[model samples]
Target: MQSPAEDSTTHAPTRDCDVLVIGGGPAGSTASTFLARRGWRVAMLEKDAHPRFHIGESLLPMNLPILERMGALDKVAAIGVRKSGADFPADGGGYNVFRFERALDARCDHAFQVRRSDFDRVLFEHAAGEGVDARQQLRVVSVEPLACGGSLVSAIGPDGPCSWRARYVVDASGRDAFLGGKRRIKRRNTRHQSAALFSHFEGVERREGVDAGNVSIYRHAHGWIWMIPLPDGVTSVGAVCYPDYMKTRRGDSEGFLMRTLRTVPEVAQRMAAATRCADVHATGNYAYECTEMAGKGWVLVGDAYCFVDPMFSSGVFLGMHGAEQAAGMVDAALREPAREAALQQALRRHIDAGTDEFKWFIYRFTSPAMRHLFANPRNVLQVEDAVVAMLAGDVFDNPRVRRRLRVFRALYAVTSLAMLPRALRNGLRRRRQSRVDFSGETLQAEES
Candidate 1:
């Protein structure tokens, strides 16, 4: 038997399993681990091998409890830099740090930042430890749901073709959203959109002492930039630019990214001595959602269901948390087939509620009112604490948080009214920018 810390390359041409999870990222691994621990025969397929390069290295404070629950906290802590808060450039000056401890939930006071290659492998390996049949470098080609039950999945592994007959399917394929794209249920989010260019750098300046590990956010006229401190003195830096600005790129990805970084004085200053250690990567169609989260014998988790702007670093938390909830619902549905529809509905409602909470803020994040409020926060009726809680991904299960968020929204509306002229001007620019289309095909292909 292979150790959980070791990847298994054992193969089978045909196999039957209770659950087939697509993608070995956070969501798929988390779901497979939970189902396997519940005694279900589970098989997880990953398109790429572990320790692969990926973006989204920053973790939210709420992710800590989930990691502990999955028994991978220590493994992650060993490789990740302890991140206590996030900072964004202020309207008039330096930066404002929103420490996790300031959030309403005291338990979620810190998180970690690591290279996604290492972080994802820890979770995937943990799932394998929990009895999941985890295999990598297997690209799922098709999933055909049977009328009776389950699905017939076809994939190409490292050696040759393979197939599986699964009683249920979970598509946690991150941004690929395999089922969503194949089934034609995925739709671009028109209200909010962006394209991202990111790379890792060595020698980028970090904050001092306790704040050294904090993620710094800088807002520019075109969009925003993120400077995330990772271990080994490598920092993950990226710029999320609106399509209109992105369409203005005249040169190579690296040159364009460097130019964009230079536009933000705060980021340019910090990177004055930094050296790019990795090739630049870019992705377009930054926001999208599937029309349906679950249907019949299949369910979608993480970016497969929906993806918004990552301004708040909510992607991983949302994906992993949804997977945890999905495992329970799927387990119940397997035993009571008649309640499948009801269970799926409940799951959709729960996931949508959490996503929408972040969406409200995300859609308005780049506006004049939001910029001013975040720059000058207040605790009137504990609204600032509520915003802090939301930043920490504590939107679910906290009645006080939910109640205070409503107050914060009301305050935001008042602020928008006060800054109506600037709000109207920025909104027009955003709308125009959102209309530009950027396939990002060349950018992604060059990476290969």
Candidate 2:
């Protein structure tokens, strides 16, 4: 992708739109589709062309409803591997699978594991089909607030420089956090920081029958690993570890990824005969969130607003869900200027409500207590089912699920107290590990 820098001589005419969406990933596409369907003059700009490679490939059962709403579920399913649920290593050996059907809400019982290249293109094209003036390879260069209201957004595309006068802006630029970074509101998470290395592979052993498509997770001393079954007999395997452990790399990222996989007996066995089919990708210090989600004329959604961890495969769901909600909020705000503040506030609360629930578990995911509980989950007070619901991305507006989640948190607290000594040791280790520096590397994907 070319830089967003514009050439002075290539200026094109400025277009007018009700909403100018930056970035055409899931969030941007969904928002554009919804707005355009509502008769708004919506324009979406994407830095890269469709069918581009992206890392997050897993989807939760909760995502089914949204996809169905957008009329793209069938398309996604056709190109995806059927993923019934997720699984984790059991303390007593074997694996403990949490089927989506077992959750409190079983209506959306299944999801698909897709190659994001295909998945994202489907959504982007769907948006264009829905009347959005979607354009690719247009990197937004600047967004300056207009004195009369709205903003002027400029970009440089194949046709050279172009601009848009937009009433409201939707910043869905993924991890670039365009507006957030520009305003200096993006903050790296202090409590939890992590790095990852991943690649696609073939010949990796997959579970048979009903479990063949489940995402497998294994906990290691320094971090955790994920094995997502993608279509075409390929698996997306990745390890998310602390910066301290990642900084110990002795060679190339591929070697480091292979060595990390070998450390986990379960993953190593599965990948023993696997042949890498793609280049190894590396990313570091990815956990972060913007202090503000919205302002006078704009709102941020998906990774542009905040990102915690991808342990539960919430990235795509959260992004699309936020876009769905943001579209509504933006619609209402456009009609009722006096209510814009309240609408943006509600949007932030809505996104954060689910995010906070996930954060509680994510912050403690690598702890001994969390590992023990997950490995030996019980249905005591139906807490396990509630957890399954949470994992399914059902964290919003479910009273029954919320009640049980509270119980689960209490249970976790008591368990932590019981394992106080071990908990303390793990906490200290995590703190020390998080403080370790990796020079100055951020998220980056490279070839072999």
Candidate 3:
């Protein structure tokens, strides 16, 4: 088959826009919408159509402000299940619940649990309504940065081969990492390696009142499971586990997932009356980061630049926030070309700061000490409040919040030392589990 660049040569340039955005997920839509609102001509290409099924349905409280700013708050709220807190159930009959309202930032006291398909479509449509030339079923196959400036983006749309000479390119290409893959900057996150298996179900039990939409996390012997209640009464359930544990599956994905669900008491009890509503899905190597995020006339956003674990439901928040930051940087670059380097550096620093704050907790999530801390939260030095702030994605502009997190980290170190034996054993086991023998087993995805 002819390459995207080769095919582009055969067809005339279909269109031109000031900014060309690849991927129409949270990141792409947010960037496109923001640029379009600023009176910049923007064109977005999405490989898949909207309303498509996707995992990572939970949303952080911090995402509310972004949505409100985009004029999508009411649209999203109409379809969302109000989520005020998070529930963590331990294997030893201990449970801890963290309410967003208790966080340092009171503005972001609550969020919503949504179906990604519906949530993403709301944002994608908002971008189009803002005058973005949003095209669905169009995949950006290759990007060639021009010698002088800008880029030549080649894509395959429903009409056939197409191309565009864009002044700037914003890559929000989810896990495809189009720009990162092309530049060979994509690197697996060795610190945390794991996979997920998930499916939706009807009849999963949920709490009453405001807690009905709270996401429930259950810790099992092997890993953890999340149960999120959607507006339509469907519950999204998934398990994140090590490759070694996943390799023991002897049957199809559906059977394996069902058997695994039974291993977690809370998840099994809640799912006992539930009926499967979707096909089983699996994705491996959950953590990755791109070495570079921005250059000359191009910038990477969302999962295109990096993806950490979804344990704290930070995926959507980070993606949308990154898009907002990248849009500002791109706007600045378009107006003041001389400051491009500084603007790019600022964007990189912004992304790194957000990811780094979450990385610490995610890296130690499965450790004995971290688990103990989360399972038995304390308010000494307002550490629990700081953690709640972090979970709410409030670490970006709050100096007071960051300081509290530092104190919490110091406390964690001291606690870990107190439980040295258990911490060491857990650390060793985690190290072994993090090393996956990819040559021996591939990622599994089976139908029910």
Tell me the spans in candidate 1 whose CA falls farther than 4 Å from its real position: 1-12, 425-448
Query: Candidate 2: misplaced stretches above 4 Å?
Result: 1-10, 425-448
lDDT of 1 by residue, 1-448 (tens): 2122211333545678899999999999999988998889999999998989988888999899988888888999999999999997776788889999999866778999989999999999999999999999999999987677789888897788788888999999999999999999999999988899999999999999999999898886678899999999999999998877776675689988997798777788899999999999999999999999998889999999999899888999999999999999999999998999999999999999989999999898878888898899888988888888998999888989999999989989999999999878876866654433244333321221
Q: Alpha carbon lDDT of residue 271, candidate 1?
A: 96
Model 2: lDDT to the true structure: 0.89
TM-score, per-candidate, Cα-based: 0.92, 0.93, 0.93
Summarize candidate 3's per-residue lDDT along 157-196 as a digit string, tens digits.
7788788778999999999999999999999999888889
Model 3 CA lDDT for position 302: 93
Output the TM-score of candidate 2.
0.93
Model 1 Cα RMSD, 1 decimal: 5.2
- Measured on C-alpha atoms, candidate 1 has an lDDT of 0.89
Instruction: Assess the local accuracy of residue 359 in candidate 2 as a C-alpha lDDT between 0 and 100.
Output: 88
Better of 2 and 3 by lDDT: 2
lDDT of 2 by residue, 1-448 (tens): 1223432445566778899999999899989988988889899999999888899999888888888888888988999998888999898789999998899856678889999999999999999999898999999999999889999898988988898889999999999999999999999999889889999999999998999999999987688999999998999999998877766675678987887788788888999999999999988777999999999989999999999889999999899999999999999999999999999998899899988888888998887788889999999988999999988999987889989999998988998889989878876866564433244344233332
